[model samples]
Target: MLHDAKLPKTLWGECIRHAVWLKNRTLTKVLQGKTPYEVAFKRKPNLANVPDWGAKVFVSKKSKSKLLVHARIGRWVGFNDDVEDFEVSKGHRIYWEDSRSVTVERTVVFRKDEGKVRGFIEVEEEGVEVGIEGEGSVNNPNNPANAHISNSPTSPETPRSESLEPV
Candidate 1:
């Protein structure tokens, strides 16, 4: 996972920890098709918050300067099980935010490769229509084209914007 994410070898430990977390949530034949997490916790894991390993994340920053950028780019590294927070890496440091505190944006733009835009994913507020740049949109959730993304559970509480203030 570390190599696939194009991350440095120094992040191997973080990658391993993330991998184990994912493994625990995955189904296995050894466990009779039940996830290890299910066996231990007696409930299905909520995978809605999981992001791609090392994917670029826009972490909100705290600053009084009006001209300063409100967000900083970081790499999604792992999850803090104790606090139920998402872990992000900025430089050599790791930051954690509560799952409820993190807002999942509908639109995601992929990075350019070889001077060409890779593609993007967009979800509308009303009915969802997921589509790639060259591919047609998929309106049906059961369609294979929409299999890559899943709808997250919504809450009545409004999403709060908080700074990724370093400790």
Candidate 2:
């Protein structure tokens, strides 16, 4: 939103600062004497291929899980801001389950000259019936594996209606 709202890109700056601080205060002192750059370099060299913070990511599918083939690509948002999640561009087909986070890429298909476009997704209207076993819903039911939770369930334990709290 900060990007789309045309707001100054300061949000990303604060995010970077927080990340540097968090690195120093991790649960373990694994990098006790080493600097972040040193530790990162030790782990892997030639970080040239590293993409932009919010560029885009498309994690390939594995044997144990189903893939949202149509949504194979997703924007590379920042480290998650609200939750422990890394930041990601807000849009459809973004959801995390268990320890796995999966998001489909968001793209606006537009014809430059004619200004005609279509939103494309990996979902299939006619073909393989891909079903995922999880507690979530797909934005486009045609693409089942792209998971999302519609809303919290209202149970007898919690009131269905919300009452305003004193401000």
Candidate 3:
């Protein structure tokens, strides 16, 4: 699904792990009509916490200001293992000065109809050249390589290569 959604390679493992976890908790033939989670815990798995991975989500505003924005837009990343909260990340960081951190929040609203939020941006490693081969590569405007391929308004006749070559 990650490849189909045009997500970056870096996210493949995370996506796969989440998928596997869900599959384990869901009914499957391998479990002999019982879900692995149910068999292990002697109870049905609570799937309500599961949200669409990479989906656009709105986290409830926790600020005390009267002019509250109501919610902050973020991308649903995964479930928090130690809590009931869902893990979410704000694209482009919360601010230039703030460290990029995933916020675990219980109040989340998924925007399923708006399409999956595969808004992950790739930050180019220092000294790595970005751009098509032999094009005097520079740092991509969309960050490492073309992170906006899936979000681009125009679709190319041929799928563009995503591999990066060292400068």
Candidate 4:
């Protein structure tokens, strides 16, 4: 599934780790409808800790430097059952580069939108194609093609600006 997803080879280890974690909890007819986790531990595995594999997430960092931000932008890649922590990617550069940015940390924030990308959602408000303004104002009704369009500040459509603000 990792290869089919077009994920890089360096991520294969992480993907395999996640797959193994999931496989242990899956039921099989050969096991008399018992999961490997249940058979080995004599208890049902906790599924609550499991998260979406490729979802965007942020990892919290513990540092002494004031310049360091509280969190690092990353993606959830794997889980380490030994330490009860998640393996998150600081960036894709860690795949090929010498950077050892991948870390196991319990403090992680997953995107609220689930399967969709964070910051922006394509909502066809009143059938208007809300997009970059070409010439006239994006919301100008003079062009029937442009209907009641709004990238409302109150809405999640403009989450990027809100996130950049000093916390």
> Candidate 3, residues 17-58: lDDT per residue as tens digits?
668778878898988899987898788888764566666677
Specify the highest-TM-score model's number. Answer: 4
The CA lDDT of each predicted structure is 0.60, 0.40, 0.58, 0.61
lDDT (tens digit, per residue) of candidate 4 on 1-167: 45643455678777877788789899999999999988977878778756567556766679899897987766667665544332233232212123534556667787666654333345756654444444454555666666655545664554435445675
TM-scores, each model vs. reference:
0.50, 0.24, 0.48, 0.54
lDDT of 1 by residue, 76-165 (tens): 666555333333321222323333122233223323221222343434465544455343445456667779766675656676697697
Expressed as tens digits, the lDDT of each residue in 27-59 for candidate 2 is: 345667555645643542233432333333444
Error of 2 at 121 (Å): 25
Best by lDDT: 4
Q: List the residue pairs that clash in candidate 4.
A: none
Best-to-worst order by lDDT is 4, 1, 3, 2
Candidate 1 at 104: error in angstroms?
17
Task: List candidate 2 segments past 4 Å from native.
Answer: 1-14, 17-36, 39-45, 61-70, 78-167
Tell me the alpha-carbon RMSD of every candidate: 15.5, 21.6, 15.1, 9.5
Report the candidate with higher TM-score, 2 versus 3. Answer: 3
Displacement of the residue 21 alpha carbon in candidate 2, Å: 9.0
Error of 1 at 102 (Å): 17
Error of 4 at 52 (Å): 1.4
